[model samples]
Target: MALPAASVQLYSLAKEFTADPQGSLDRLAAIGLKNVEAFDFVRRPAEIRSALDASGLVSPTGHAPLLTDELWTPDGSIPTPAPEVVFEAAAAIGIQTVIDPFVAPERWLTEEGVADIAERLNSAAEKAATFGLNVGYHNHAQEFVASFGDHTAYERFVSLTDERVQLELDLFWALTGGQDVPALVSRLGDRLTAVHVKDGIVPASNPWAPGAEAFGSDSLDQRHAGTGEVPLAAALRAGSAIQYAVIEYDRAPGDVFADIEASLGFLREGGFVA
Candidate 1:
């Protein structure tokens, strides 16, 4: 299947956006990006829309807490009011899919816990639906490793979540968890709605945990999509169900814009986009 034009994952350009969101977005658009996904956007809705209209960029995906404690005052508790506010903000900004990237502690692990998460996700999806939005979950390596009962967290999530709730498959982390990207997508079927296109070259010493100072920095040596070891073509084949393919590299060599340019060039040559 032919892929859509690549979308920029704004987390890769978080620094730039923080400094000057409108200008940064315009520059990204000038560089041939017409779509984007963001964890948090600095611009207001009107500002974002104006910039996008000028740049011809569309933002379809958003990231926020699913049921995290941070939104609430206390630690490890979900606040009733915050979800509504978050939902409204995303909907206002023209975000079609709002993703909860992590499972809160109370909703993590155990069969019952998995079921609870499914129920919560379903509720969020229902709420989002009223505003013409879809709710989804994005996975990291942890989801594949975090097991509950007979199934891994990813398995449980796919099994228990309602059909309406979708998934944003982070391919690099899926690989890090020792799962085949296409195989997992095939198994999940239509529930897989989006993807994070990232790659890495981990040291052989500890492929999953490369250094002692901070595992976060080394677990995956974030790099441009096609520059690392990920089998890009095979993964895209598996991602037949996806609509938006988001490029994200948590860390880049040299300047960030250059890194993004390199990634886009690689994808264009590979025929993922025109």
Candidate 2:
């Protein structure tokens, strides 16, 4: 397969992007990036699309909540919009896939819960197609905390979902969940279309585990890609059909732009992305 394209999650520079969408996108373009993965874009699709156009960037994939009533984040929860609304916004922003970025830990703890999650996503996938788009899920550590018959909740959910429901694995979080990251990537194979290429010193324990203390993104020691614990190069190499190697940082170690540039440099020097 051809090497995946390099993209950055706009959430990596959330504050800056929120403050000046056009200027921030321009800076990313100057850094030689041609694509971005949008975050929280449902409310401002036209503005983001305009900014992307001005900067000669395109957002082929973006994050939005799809399978839940409320979207969970490290910081807090945000109300979810209807699936149709999400697809309309994504289409407006020229996004080809709308990825649900997170689900609560509790929901992944039981076989029934995992099935429900898959069912909802499969239903969302059907709805998404009407708008000429696709739907996917992005994982954190929560999905790994539970298992059924030797398969992780993450894996089980994968098996249960429709073939059209894509997957985006977050490397650092997979490591945090004590997974063999590259092996998981290899197993995911073609269904894995995108990856959040984040690197960081993983937390001592699964923060999303039951009874774990609450933590926020600011508390994480996220670093530039290939500079921390995640086996990014191996993971990227293991993917059979990954189309986007997306750089992201839950918390940048320094200036966000410079941090993003450093990660992008890793992708280029390693020939991991086109």
Candidate with best lDDT: 2
lDDT of 2 by residue, 87-178 (tens): 99999999999999998899999999999999999999999999999999999999999999999999999999999999999999999998
What digit string (tens of lDDT, one per residue) describes model 1 on residues 15-133? 78868877888888878888888655422566666666677777888777765545321113333336677778777777888888656433444567777778888898888888888
In candidate 2, which residue pairs get closer than 3 Å at backbone N, Cα or C atoms, i.e. clash? Answer: none
Taking all chains together, each candidate's TM-score versus the true structure is 0.85, 0.99
Off by over 4 Å in 1: 42-44, 71-81, 104-107, 148-150, 202-214, 217-220
lDDT of each: 0.71, 0.94
Reference-based TM-score, model 2 = 0.99
lDDT of residue 124 for candidate 2: 93
User: In lDDT terms, how accurate is model 1?
Assistant: 0.71
Residue range with the least summed lDDT across 10 consecutive positions in model 1: 71-80
All candidates: CA RMSD in angstroms?
4.2, 0.7
